[model samples]
Target: MQKLRGALIGCGFFAVNQMHAWNDVEGAVIVAICDRDPERLAAVGDQFGIARRYADAAQMFADGGFDFVDIATTVQSHRALVELAAAHKVPAICQKPFARTLSDAKAMVAACRTASIPLMVHENFRWQPPIQAVRKALDAGAIGEPFWGRFSFRSGFDVFSGQPYLAEGERFIIEDLGIHTLDIARYILGDVKSLTARTLRVNPKIKGEDVATILLDHEAGATSIVDVSYATKLGTEPFPETLVELDGTEGTIRLSQGYRLEINNAAGTTVTDVSPKLLSWASRPWHNIQESVFAIQQHWSERLRDGGETSTSGADNLKTFALVEAAYESAASGSPVEIGALL
Candidate 1:
């Protein structure tokens, strides 16, 4: 099989993990890299040993040498970069939250569909080992006919230390972190029918709401609660861990702290450790997320090579992105927001 040459745009904090992941991917390589910041571009280029580098995206697209492009830039730049990739007839993998707004996301997807290029949003939380374990248990009927669920990600970790811009955003958690948890809820339960939400800002230092609880009515008749907070302080911090509770007709499945998975049903209770494998480049606390980044990127490479649509293809992620939009609307209006109407 011929290796797929991929160009990575953006050399930010998270992009380093992506660069490392691309190195480990079986059928792909980062032949080129682009970043607006020369220092970042040079640093990543030197680290990855990528010779081709570009300061301008248009220049990179014009002199395209790679088969696909990975846009790891912020949300504000996603639509433009994806559209540029479409124009260049290059398959694209964009980081989430896919775009600044639902309308922009829809337009980006439409552009790629028109160009007949595969477009994937980097929604990797569902690919986390523990999360996948939960999904597998659901598929195996360990939890039959899931009726109610809760996806909770509460942490007091100082996220601002690494990404100071996070604290500056007027729309913080829901757009930044909650989007992942919301997508995870949709992944486990099903597509949502409607969503009602409430938001609060416990930390006055930040501009946006630090806490949000969203009530989702799933199309499959299951209801779910997605709650996220950066203000919750615990005896032992569950930073970066997503704790899940699922109740089904047969029994229940609990994905607890420390990657512990428990399933209770007619066969009796079974407990297992579903911890993520710590990659050599990964660190403690963030290893789970780092591992997921690799898993999703590998999935993208395989799907692209096989001419198959990715799990988080642009068309599919619009449904997940709709939940983000619905959550904010619902939180502000104090009413249920219909998912269909927004999508």
Candidate 2:
């Protein structure tokens, strides 16, 4: 198959993993990379062997013969950059926290839809190796019919070291980190029909809530609780680990910390480790995220080759977006929010 030439805009922390994945992906090539910072541009460009580098996305988009553009900039710049990309008729893959707000996200999605171009959100948490392994088991009926589940992430890892901007941001864990965990719940169970959320700004120094508990009612009769926190001091628990508890009609599946898969049913309890292959970027607590970047890139490559669809398409991510809005609203009103009404 032919490789799809692409340009990566934004040479931020997460963008590094994408560059690595793009190298190994069969049907994709990074012909150009753009970053406002010339230092980042030169560094990532040289490392990836991408000769074409630009300080501006428009210049890169105009000059580079790329089939698509990957926008990995901050959430605040997403709408403008994506709008420009859509105007150029370039299919786009945007990093998540789709936009700063629902209206902006709607505009970006609407623009791409009107231009008849594929626009997908890069929501890659569930694609993490061990996470995918759990997803596969659920699909294979190892956990029978799923009825309940929880996705939890807690840690005090210095996430601000690389993305120091996160520490000074207006929004914290929910929109920043919680989005991934919430999307994971939606991925495993299904679209949320209703949700009740409680959020806390445990760390008063920053603006957004650092701790959140979300209760979701999935359309498929599955109930899920997703909790995320960046305030949890790491003593015994490692940095940023998502613990999943899945209860099915006839059995149960517990996937967390390493690759343990426990199945409890009438046939007695059986345990297995069906973790997915780790990516080169995977290490320590960030391994899941690293593996995810690779898997999602491969998923993108496969879709391009086979004319398939991305799991995190703009239309699909609208649901995840609704959950974010509801979380904030619920936090304000101190009550449960119905997700279906948002659509």
**The 10-residue segment with the lowest total lDDT in model 2:** 274-283
Best by TM-score: 1
Candidate 2 to truth, TM = 0.95
lDDT by residue (tens digit), candidate 1, 48-149: 899999999999999988999999998889999999999999999999999999999999999999999999999999999999999999999997899999
Clashes of 1: 0
lDDT of 2 by residue, 1-343 (tens): 6789989999978899889888878889989899999998898988888888899888877775988888999887899999998999998999999998888888899999899888889998878766776788788887688999999888767777778777787678888888989888988998998888898877766666789998898999988999988888865765556788999988888876656777787788877775555666556666667767878888887776666778999888888999999988888898888887886
- RMSD, one per candidate, in order: 0.6, 1.6
Global lDDT of model 1: 0.95
Please, what is the whole-model Cα lDDT of each candidate in the order they appear?
0.95, 0.84
Off by over 4 Å in 2: 274-278
